[model samples]
Target: MSGERARILVVDDEKVIRDSCTRILTTEGHIIKSAENGNIGLEVFREFHPDLVLVDLKMPGKSGMDVLEEIESIDPNVVQIVITGYATVSSAVDAMKRGAYDFIPKPFTPEEILLIVGRGLEKRRLLLESEALKVEHERIRRNMISLVSHELRAPLAATVQYLEVILGGMAGEIPSEAKEMIVRCDIRLQEMLELLRKWLNLATFDSPKMAEHFQDISLSDIATESIELMKSLAEEKKISLILETSKDLPPIKGSKVSLEEIFNNLISNAIKYNKAGGWVKVILYGREEEVWVEISDNGSGIDEEHLSRIFDEFYRVDGRRNAPIKGSGLGLSIVKKMVDAHGGMIDVESKFGEGTTFRIGFPKFFQRQKEG
Candidate 1:
């Protein structure tokens, strides 16, 4: 009745009260309906689905209290106003606790009805608008992430591969200095690629639709493969990629894509943040109830102050700023999210200048576990 038309229902045993309310509200460009008793009020409520309801506190068949409870059961947010011939302070307060939006005494002025009902309708419109805005913002965020992941990343990856070929001397021979420069450019390109990948993965996990697709699969197989994939990166820095996988390391209930993401990020960080000629060690052992993974590196270790926030998005260790390595700092954050979604635990222990260690435990039966 204020900015937008509203649906209102009035329930009163008195024909005069019902008729008076209908005439007053209907003149304000509102859709109004009336019921003579509480039972018929409920029937009209369902059929009309009115946004606001007015019911007399004392009725012949069923009381206004009964109709208020029934309306609450249907939708707790619906606005309700209680009416009575004798206005009592205690009764008005009690009606409010029963979920009535307002209480008016019998012989309410038409102006009083319009003012109270208008306020309720405005509140409902604001709540609905707020919800719509939130949904729209989420949709736009998802679209931007999808576009960057596919459109921008594809071209950058191709360029990195082409530069790798030139640095590898697949093209005509070039000066040693020029070759070194190309390698530096290649490394920067690779950093960009990793950032894009990690950022995209972070957004994917953030989406509500990214629910876990768990499966009973060999965790050892995925770990081994992730380790092998990082061997090349380790070699680039002259670091050794060592693995100690127990022969009986069993399967885990997890998403294959997410599990691979978790393992790859841990192993990749060990290499990226390590000193040249250092080593990355990956150990996989199983407890009776869980599988434990430990990846340790003796690279430029993280300080204690940074350890607490290492899993936060876009958080980079300050100690590594002057170091040659660069990153988006979302790697560990993504790992933590994927692990948490699978109902697993991940933690890190690091010494300022000595080294760092990461431990992960995956339960035998994850809640979303499915057969691979």
Candidate 2:
């Protein structure tokens, strides 16, 4: 009774027992309420939301087990203790099966009643704490989604408006160099948008009811398309783009869209971080059970310390000070997530001031001789 006092409800058909129990609990500095029968007790339970409930098994209107079921339906976490006069071992076992926290005989001492009530109150406190933690976690997740949405949308919107003007010829007689610059900007914007979409999709996939789509597709074709998509950006920077893929490469079983996105992000990053007039090489090789793809670039390589956290969301190697080469910092993270979704593995090898290489391994699904 020295601990925190809890709100308790006493339910019994006997007026004397109900009143006496309420008096004893109230004297101990605990808030108490009394109900004549189980039906009335249920009404009081909804209104009071007591932390603990004490119900007599032999009731006139509704049985104690009935009351326990109703209370559990209202809030399963509410602690329930059963009291009975003709207490048999079987009856006590039955009460526990119906969700009662504990049982006490009618002729029990005040000390016994207080001890059982205290235990029930402690259980209630733990249930409330668990519910609070779950709610807090959900709130933080929502906040993260809101922040990422606002931060990613602004740059994408600007890029879209610029492209619309150029494509509409609203900016009349644009120079070839200026058009190419706009297109490069457009590509970066598209990359940012794709990263955002991947993050959102990953969240959806984490739900238990979501399904993943997998299919058999040619890894060589997917890699080639990704390389061609970023070829313009490489040309603009005077970077040489090379693709070395075996003609007899095996197909991979996975989501083609996800695979394409992963390759696109890696290849784009290789171009983005490469030095002017440097080179990017993409190679594909088929093994017995799996296929390997590597994208390597001659550029400013990632530092050893920062490489570990490169896959973290919104994590950038260069701070905001590096405006000319700044990125949204979600490309590699998205790539890693997509690879994981496909049940594949991806790794990065880099040395500072030298270059970086990203290697991905996929399970082979098609016969290499089909194309021949």
TM-scores across all candidates? Answer: 0.67, 0.57
**Local accuracy of candidate 2 as per-residue lDDT tens digits, 171-191:** 788888988888888877776
Clashing pairs for model 1 are 215-370
Model 2: clashing residue pairs?
none
What is the C-alpha local distance difference test score of candidate 2? 0.82
When summed lDDT is taken over every stretch of 10 residues in candidate 1, the lowest stretch is: 205-214
Question: Which portions of model 1 miss their true places by more than 4 Å?
Answer: 1-6, 9-126, 158-184, 206-213, 235-242, 245-247, 276-279, 319-323, 369-372
Give the C-alpha miss distance for residue 174 in model 1, angstroms: 7.2
Candidate 1: tens digits of C-alpha lDDT, residues 1-372: 356779999999999999999999999988999999999999999999888899899998888888998898898768899987779988888888888988889898999988888987876676667777999999998898978877888988998988888877899898999988888888788878888888887776642244444568787788789988887888888999888889888888778888898888888888888888898888889998999999999988898888899999998885476656667788889989988887789989999767889999999876653432
Each prediction's Cα RMSD?
A: 6.2, 8.8
Best by TM-score: 1
Per model, how many backbone clashes are there?
Answer: 1, 0
